[model samples]
Target: MAKGIHQEIIGRPHNLLEHYQPIDGVVDEMVDASGNPRPVWKDFIEALEGLGPEKLAQRFARADQYLRDAGVYYR
Candidate 1:
């Protein structure tokens, strides 16, 4: 199944929002193996969820490009 469909299947509208929180001096955070922690999502993606998949994808792509342009990320 597609990713949007998968998120719908899991009923994660709010969880998606929460998953993409913003922070200072950090990229992002997530649980790693052994119940440890790691970082992810250098930008906020949850806000785009309500914009529908196409727009969300466009926004994400744009944000990704911006991050790359700003040298915060590479390719």
Candidate 2:
């Protein structure tokens, strides 16, 4: 994450960071060492979190269907 870059969460329905627990030795690309969200990921994650569980599940299902329709498969 770049220093001096910041993003504000507008109309946030929830504090998305409430559930994040950074692992001691793992590197996080979307969050800083102090547990603040990186500028680029802040809005994106908040939007996703704002979708709520049911809508999120539907979106995931749609994504999976798209992948399967496109012949994206794994062994």
Candidate 3:
């Protein structure tokens, strides 16, 4: 999904501005306009990359199980 987001951002033309609007004076927190990950996100992206898909899925499942056990929900 992260890779998909990156691809979507990079696939757009530079002149296209209708897809997203930035908050006044605030930079995009995740990817740049060019779809490149920001420096601040480097370590996090690296960690996810290191975990690979299977481990990441396992971790996500564990987190979901924990949330279920704790009765966490959104209305």
Candidate 4:
């Protein structure tokens, strides 16, 4: 019975790609212009969707902490 990040941020719309719009003649790496997962990313997206937003946020926080502890930086 775990709550998701989406749950934490209640009363807000959860459009993952609200601002995404595919331009003409360009190739999208993950989702299509319609915001549907592309064929190649189907499985990966499904797995992440199963994890829910809270878990994903926690994972991201852990990764960020790890990078900070390890002194990893981007220029």
Candidate 5:
């Protein structure tokens, strides 16, 4: 299985990374605002990174589509 650049960005499958990046980046940025690492966001990211690529991708696609349908836009 080849790892992709997007995967490395979130330390998970590329698809999963796409689904979670917004949430992750938001949590990370918010935590950073407090000048400390937020355990909730950190643990979630770690847990996501441990899933199998296929499984992670499935989740990613689902979340991605849902967000899109809901008009959740990102840069």
Candidate 6:
């Protein structure tokens, strides 16, 4: 079911913002007005995208588990 989805490819990952639609008259912090990712965030975004959704999810899950084990909780 996720095969055709941009973020659900098995071995290949597409641009995370391939379908990003910035609201009109809104200032986006990640991308520029031209829809290209800003230079400052380009590498960071690429690195995360390279991790793919599954790996990113796993990392986040691990982090959450660690936080819970450490007694970290949101106020």
- Number of the top-ranking candidate, with lDDT as the measure: 6
Q: Write model 5 residue lDDT over 1-75, tens digit each, in one string.
A: 233332434434433334433344354552554444466666675666677666666666667677778988775
What is each predicted model's overall lDDT from 0 to 1? 0.47, 0.68, 0.58, 0.63, 0.54, 0.72
Question: What tens-digit string does per-residue lDDT give for candidate 1 at 1-75?
Answer: 223233342334434445534455564455333333344532344444556655555555666666667978433
Whose lDDT is higher: candidate 1's or candidate 2's?
A: 2
Between prediction 1 and prediction 4, the one with superior TM-score is 4
Better of 2 and 5 by lDDT: 2
Candidate 1 lDDT:
0.47
Question: Candidate 1 at residue 12, lDDT?
Answer: 42
Question: Residue 15's C-alpha lDDT in candidate 2?
Answer: 66
- Candidate 6 clashes between residue pairs 3 or more apart in a chain or in different chains: none
How much is 28 displaced in model 2, in angstroms? Answer: 3.1
Which is better, 5 or 6, measured by lDDT?
Answer: 6
Q: Per-residue lDDT for 5-73 in model 3, tens only?
A: 333434334333335465556778866767566799877877865665556656666666676689886
Which ranges of candidate 5 are over 4 A from the true structure?
1-43
| Colliding pairs, model 4 | 5-54
Clashing pairs in 2: none
RMSD over all Cα atoms, model 2: 11.2
| Candidate 5 residue pairs in backbone clash | none
Per-residue alpha-carbon lDDT of candidate 4 for residues 39-70, written as tens digits (9 for 90 to 100): 99878766755666667667756666677689
lDDT of 3: 0.58
* Model 3 segments more than 4 A misplaced: 1-27
Worst 10 residues of 2 by lDDT: 1-10
Task: Rank candidates by TM-score, best first.
Answer: 6, 2, 3, 4, 5, 1
Best by TM-score: 6
